[model samples]
Target: MTSQPRPGPAVFISAGEASGDQHGAAVAREIRRELPDVRLFGIGGRELEAAGVSRIAGLDELSVMGGTEVLRRLPGFFRLQRRIEGLFVTEDVRLLLPIDYPGLNLRLARSARRQGRRVLYYIAPQVWAWREGRARKLQRDCDRVLTVLPFEGPLLERYGVRTEFVGHPLLDAPRSRAAAARDRAAPGVRMTDSRRVIGLFPGSRAQEVRFMLPVFAEAARQLARRHQDLDFLVARPPHLPKSLYAGAGFPTAGAREVTERSWAALTKSGTITLELALAGVPMVVGYRTGGLEWAIGRRLVRIPSIVLVNLVAEAPVVPEFLQDRLTAERVAAELEGLLGERAAGRREMLRAFDVVRERLGDPGCAARVASHAIELLARDQESPGRLGTPC
Candidate 1:
């Protein structure tokens, strides 16, 4: 009898929040396209599940951010780390795809190396902004780093990590522009009906949503008093329960739709700001963490601008509020200026949006990442244990 075909290579991925889940799903979709029979399992949210990646480990367990919060969950983190390490060993996994959650994924990468697994880190960490020391560790742990930002390649190269600029995945896979155009052109749709809609993205994490939504709602309430026709839409992450927004006042939409319909967005600074920028929606960025974490982060983070849009452009395209500066009244005032009625302000923001989109590069980032993974897998088969060399 002819010998059976060898089994497809084993692989595992890990991502932390809903944003990571979305990007992980994008990468998985492409990986499936390249290697139809490849094993794709990961710890991510609903989006990854939809893209054919099974959630062997829960995303919620790793959803937390902030130093104090992370410290509180050290025991659980250690136990989870052991559980993941055991899975990698037992599965005989050949590859590890760790997306944007650098805090834990870096450790997992080291463990993967120890177990003879190759790692391709998608969406390199913000070492350019904070915790610059981690890039040196990344060089030792990961086989290659696929970065979204155009500038990150040189930065990581200096630290000795083999890196590639995959371009921003969002640029290649824009959600709102075409859909918003179609919606505007549809027979029944009317901008007047929505009436100066404002999108609010408090955040994707449960703790962050709980902290920011109430404050955001209050700002919306105040803005409503000045502009009676103003409507509000909260962009809900797929992983969170609607109960998270139970008392917080606003209609809800998927993150993509919120970008399509809103004239302005009141946002918590995060990766979603890049989405908002891509949508060409003028917005005010703000965030709050536990007081101690905020204090600690302030001391550590070197960047003057926390908003991704601002950092990418190296210009203050939008305002940022933090700590004592982030207040309902202050946010309400800033958002009121970005309202659809403020033609001058909205026009200026759109000009800034064009600059961001150009820097982001075009779509097809997912496919590039897939190509990298496929090449890495082929090499692992070629050399067996010599898998960690620069890809």
Candidate 2:
């Protein structure tokens, strides 16, 4: 009998949240398009599953925000980590592609490096915001780091990390939707329909939703009382149960659809702020967490602004309320100034958003990421010893 050819190498992807799942799925599709027979597997969510990645674990078990919240789920995370490490062995995973979720992915990268697996980190951790040492850790553990932000490449390179600016993935989203919204309501022209929509984006994690949804709802109620034509829509994450949004007193929809129709938004800080900016929605950003998390975060975060839009714009393009300051009344007050098409704050924010978009680079971010991943895999195969050393 003829000996069978050896099975091709498999890739393990770890995308620990909703946004990462979307990015991971896009990259996975692009990867398969180039290498149809390559096996893709690991931890992700519904999007990854639909993209043909064999998930060993789901985001439901892994997605949590704040240090204190993660502590509560520590035992489960440890178990999942061990399970993933085992999959690396059994599945013969040659490459580890980690997308964000630095908390767990960083640990896994270290483990994979020890096992002679090459690691390519995507959507790099916000080390500039906090724990700046993680930049060195990423350099030590990852073979290459792909960043979405324009400035992150130079920052990571300073730490001697192999870095690439793949451009912001948000730009890949259809601009026509946002463009149409803007066309419908030009800078000086109010909506002829006499109705305006406000999107309330609570965020993807359970902790974020639990902490932010009620406050957002209350803000919406306040805004509703002041303006009769204003309508509120909640951008609900698919993973969260409907009951989580049940008493929020607003109609719930997918984030993209809500963003496309929004005149302005009350949003929780994080990637959603960037998404809202991309959609040209003037937004008031807010974030709240458990007391322990807030106390610890306030001390650790190095940057003055937590909002991504402001960070990208390199200016305070939108109002941000965090921790103790994130009251519904305060959010409503800030949002009130952004309610009109001709509102000064709204017009100025939209202009800043335009600058933000221009700086984000062109689209095809996922394709570039996939190309790099494949190149790394090929190089590893040709000279395994080059990436074999553990950090």
Candidate 3:
């Protein structure tokens, strides 16, 4: 009698937001290249779907910010978590690859580990910023943590977590040489009759947009009154509807194009700050959330700077107006410095960005992360008995 064939290995990835989706997609593509027959599935957005990952749920369903926001969606998240954990058993998933979205992904990692599945975390949770205790949890749950930031690997290693510095995926992004050169040469100097563009990047999530866009719009109006040559370009995430940006009263476009054309920017504090920095655009960072969320975050956050660019630079290279400080007047005033002809703040930030880029290391980051995950999978197959030891 002919025997039934054994099922191939499977990887379950969870990337809960736009940036994570982008990074996860790149890694997924690389994994497919190396292991063509491997089963790939995940919870991500269009990018991951395009990369051949069969999504159990779209990123929008899982993406929420702030404490209160997450609490309201907690029941759905719990149900989704249960469903995903059930898939580990039914599908015989060999690995759980989580990309960011630490709030949910951390719980999933613990669950996957409990089920004797290997966990490889990408773009590891910023435990260094707030809950340093989570580092120990990562040590216990994740088989390996692939970090994008240069400093994270060292930090995680201290907690006994296996770590790899995979270089930031943003370095692989296509950059506009013209834009970089202009920013480096002029440093936001607005010449006679030359149109200068200031990009407004509120954020990717609906909640973030709701909190930031109106304030950003008011800031734009204030700036417009002062500078006739200045034009506004809002960087809209593709997943969000156009109506979300309608109140901003600016032409909306993709983040890449907007960053390339921008002389300066007023942006939300996140990975986009790093993206703008890499593109050589000086920016003023702002973030606002529900009052309760802001209060809790203020108490929990241990770091001096929340902006990634500033954190990477180890200095406050960009002005951050967060929570109550995130007013239209403050944002406009800070951006004004960035737009001036001989703005020291602008030149200093541009110079710091150069150092930040060099520190991030070279590209091919996704390939490194993919290889690490694939290696972990191979090890598990070779020594199936070792899978449940650490957990």
What is the TM-score (0 to 1) of candidate 1?
A: 0.93
1-391 in candidate 1: lDDT tens per residue?
9999977777787988777788889888888887888887788888888899867766777788777788889898888888888888777788999997887899999899887788999999899889999998789989999989877899999999999888898876556654456334433344545466889999888888877888899999998888888899998876678989988778898888888887788999978898888877789987988888888888899888989988888788899888678899999988877664435776687778888889988788888988998888999989985765545
lDDT tens digits by residue: candidate 2, 134-236:
9988988998899998888888888899888989999898875555758566567656567889999999888889999999999999889989999999998
Ranked by TM-score from best down, the candidates are 2, 3, 1
Query: lDDT by residue for model 3 over 129-215, one digit each (tens)?
Result: 888899998999998888888889888899898888889999998779746466546534444448889999999999999999999
lDDT of 3: 0.89
Model 3 residue 40 CA deviation (Å) reads 0.5
TM-score of each: 0.93, 0.97, 0.95
lDDT for each candidate structure: 0.83, 0.89, 0.89
Question: In candidate 1, how many Å is residue 205 off?
Answer: 1.0
How does residue 32 of candidate 2 score in lDDT?
A: 93
Q: Which candidate, 1 or 3, has the higher TM-score?
A: 3
Question: In candidate 1, residue 65 scores what lDDT?
Answer: 72
Better of 1 and 2 by lDDT: 2
Error of 2 at 35 (Å): 0.4
